[model samples]
Target chain A: MADWDWDFTWEILPRLLAATVNTLLAAGIGYIIAMFLGLAFALAQRTPSNTLTMAVREAVEFIRSTPLVLQIFFVFYVGPEFGVVLSPWVAGMIAIGLHYAAYLSEVYRGGLENVPQGQWEAATSLNLSTARTYFRIIIPQALPPSIAGMGNYLVGIFKDTPVLSVIGVAELMQTANSIGSENYRYLEPYTMVGIIFLLISLPSAALLRSFDAWVRRKLGMN
Target chain B: MSYFEFLVAHGDLLLSGTLVTAMLAAVSIALAIVLALTAGLMRLAPAGPVRWVATVYIEFFRGTSLLVQLYWIFFVLPLFGLSLDKFTAGFIGVGMNLGAYGAELVRGAILSVPKGQWEAALAINMSPLTRMRRIILPQALVIMLPPWGNLLIELLKGTALVSLISVADLTFQAKQINATTFMSAKAFGTALIIYYVMARFIITPLMRWLERSMARKLGRA
Candidate 1:
């Protein structure tokens, strides 16, 4: 029985904070990948080709239903068997990015759906290409409504970044695990991980909610 | 195929692991339902310590990662002499996390049950508890089921983390078999399909049925 150790906590704070940067980088890179992939998925599902739509829809559903931790393992562990070996960081980012992309595609689908038939018709009437319609007219309108859901998943991807620790990503959770194993003091490191997540995620969630409202107002949709 | 041979060899282990995963999902989801209702009610309580406590629980559980929480409860609580087996810690970690999210859905559903219903119950001189029991809760339950279905799936996925705690769930079994056989594709692939089946064929349809039955019972079908 050891009591709470402040001295040990101070010694470990810098190490934990240093690893927080890696965690942020992993999440940041993963979020960007998800954003692009999710939009592609959302668009793929809406294409005129029924087969493509069905395939993409099934892909998204399969991804969403399965556990992300397993997906991370699959990508990292199984990739080598197919001669598609990737580092832990690369595999982790792809797996998590793919998992959240499934969720984000749904969010995008909802936003894209909310854009009226009139917008499409008007673009057609104006003789605009599909690309011009999406880029110049529709996507901007779709974006404001999507912002809140997108932000939630952004926070979601961050929370899920810890799963990457399993693959030796050296992110916050993995770093904390090493610290605990090294010092044999699980309490401080684990508790601090929880605290760091709360401190980062809570305010960001709040900010995103307000930002969503602001965007909606700015777009005159609300 | 090599995968079929692998399965033929290790099918029993995978089957047992699937059973463990199912058990974990069922127990944790049950716990989550109870906790969600309790906290949801507490959240709607007029401003006070109860509401404050519920809010804090929801925020803390929702804000942090479940893996971190599971590690804390399983790894740290023993230091304070409150040791729990992996299953106990596993379900608690997931149940609490899901409950926090479910609490919001519960509150939202209850609040969504139009204002007039509460006013009407008040006009009829119904007690508050009776109003909730007889009037509000029944309606709110139907509204909440679809979202609760999603949460249940999330709970099922989250149980994978219990493997990290060495719970011998489907994921752990897959990992173990992989270590020995070095057949990562077959092991993890089978595990993924089993999970997908559980989610889509089992949990999703089951939830859809419940939602429909509840709607019919409430005369809203």
Candidate 2:
């Protein structure tokens, strides 16, 4: 049986810390993509074109229904066959981005739906153009309620960055796996990964809650 | 090979894989429900220490990724002389992870019960247990069902990760078939479709039926 080794833990901590930076970078890029694409998906569902709405809705459902790792494999492996090759980083970002976009779109849909119909009527009465109404009025109202959900997914995408390791993205999980294989020590690296995640997620979750309330108060929506 | 030929060849393997996935999901969800109830109730406990334990459990589980948790259980535990089989590790890892999320849902639902209901139970001189079983839980069950539906689907998707630890689930079989045949689209595509059908058609409707029946039982249908 193996016992814990403090010296080895100290030695690998720097490498793990470097991988953590990559993990955060992956999460940040993925989240930026998800936020915009999610809005597109959410708004597409509300469009007057039945085909567009159906297509976007189906796409979201399909993505949500399937596993992220499978999608990652599909894109990374199968893309070259279709003449759209990508780097591991690009492929990982696209897969994770799209997967979470489906979820974030759902959050946006709920927020959009929560806005009263009378608000739209009021905007119409005020002679606001469709784009103006959406950008100026509806979006501000929609955002306060969606902040908490959006924040959850922010942390969610962060935690899920580990899946990119499967595609050899050099994120924290991949780094930890390699470290484990190299030293034949699983205990330290895995525990450190969990600790890193908890340390970030717990504080961010609390902050998001407070931020949610702050947004509501700031918008005077309550 | 044609898709039909592929199905004829590997259909049984995939089906058996599906069964394993289902069994993993079932065992994990069953265990999760038990854990969620205990922790949820403990979260409402008057004692600070008990509540703190429940909070820590939920936070630690919720904060980490399920894949990491599974790896820790499957890989790290053996170093400590606690060797678990793939199934047991998958079961515990997934169960505890989902339980943390479910416990929050459980706590939220119980708290959403109206204050009047508790007052009325008190007025009727019912015991706390009786009041909970009869009055509070029924309504909370209805409130809990929809989110539980989402969690169930999430748990079902999470079973795919168990493939990493050499569990013979659908994802593992997909990888195996793809490696041997080099049929990336055929193998992985089929796995994706199977997961879609199971989640969208089978498990989803079943969850809806459960939710509806619970609502009907409470005359809230």
Candidate 3:
């Protein structure tokens, strides 16, 4: 077994940290896409058209059932033949975002479902337009219950960012891989990447738990 | 080549790859269930070191990314003189990570069991071990079945990471075909369809049947 090398560890720290920003960026951008797309998906299922609902629901199930990495590959590779060429970063973001959006839509669906049927009836009784009912009355109520699941997926999206590295996105995992290969030392880089992930995710999870509680209280839901 | 031709040429390869994928998923689920049971029981134990240790293990595993864990085991463990073959490393990573999630489900399911059931068991003068083995676990098992089924699907998808570690799973075969033929559409599209079929057709039906059987066994059907 090779002895530990502190100097090599110190030398690689800066590069990994730089890549950390890119990892966060990818997660953040991907999350933004998922959050909006997920809402659309959740709402689509509740629409009046049977074909639209079934089609979207099946799409969500298919997406959720498959692996995220394969989706990343599909988007990156298969898009070209359809004349939808995209850079690695762009493709990675779409794939990751779409994958999580499927999961989040379920969360959204649950939240929306819990918004008592009376609320919908009340909105109709008020003669409010459909858009106004959803955006103004219904969504505000759905927001609190959705916060916890949304927060979980936020962390989930953060952790899955490493998969983007497979497509050469220059994120932390990719950076770690390149660093290890360049120096013929895989131990330090991979460990550092793990440490970085743990440090961020653990606290954010705790924070999210408290945030969920806080949102509930603010909405007076107990 | 057309997607049909691609499948005709490489159907056997694809099927064998899927067999490996299914095996990986099966072994990993078994491993995860064992770890989850152990750690889950630990987390619920009377407040002590075991509980604390379980808490730490769950948080540590759940917090870190899976790919990093796989890479560390596959790449870095050998530096410390513990060498695992690639398949062993693959399932261990996927199993242990999912096990953390499973542990929570276990904890939740157990807690969901009515406190009255425990009190009744105590009134019957059942030994602690027997009480848990007979009453608590049976009730908890029913409550946990649905979530466990979901985790099985997740476990199946997780086996895909093994391909990255160079395991010859379904995904590895797809990537291989894509590389050779540059037929990204036929290769990846076909792979996607197969995955969708396995998940939607096979796993979903299987889970539904299991859920129904468990509910019936529990007399809640």
Relative to the true structure, candidate 1 reaches a TM of 0.99
Ranking by TM-score: 1, 3, 2
Q: Candidate 3's residue-wise lDDT over B1-221, tens digit each?
A: 66578779989888988899988888898899999999999998987999999999899899999899999999999999999999999999999999999999999999999999999999999998999999898889889988887888888888888899999999999899889887887777777778888888888899889878878987899
DockQ of each: 0.85, 0.78, 0.84
Q: Residue B125 CA error for candidate 1 (Å)? A: 0.8
Q: Which residue runs does candidate 1 get wrong by more than 4 Å? A: none
Give me the candidate number with maximum lDDT.
1
> Candidate 2, A208: how far from true, in Å?
1.1
Candidate 1 lDDT tens digits, B197-219: 99999999999999999999988
Q: Which scores higher on lDDT, 1 or 3?
A: 1
TM-score of 3: 0.98
Better of 1 and 2 by TM-score: 1
Two-way lDDT contest, 2 vs 3, winner: 2
Stretches of candidate 2 above 4 Å error?
none
**Pairs with steric clashes in candidate 2:** none
Per-residue lDDT tens digits of candidate 2, residues B1-221? 89999999989888989899989999999999999999998999899999999999999999999999999999998988899999999989999999999999999999999999999999999999999899998899899999998888888888888998989999889888878887778888999999899889988899999999998998888
How high is the lDDT of residue B185 in model 2? 82
Alpha-carbon deviation at A81 in model 1, angstroms? 1.1
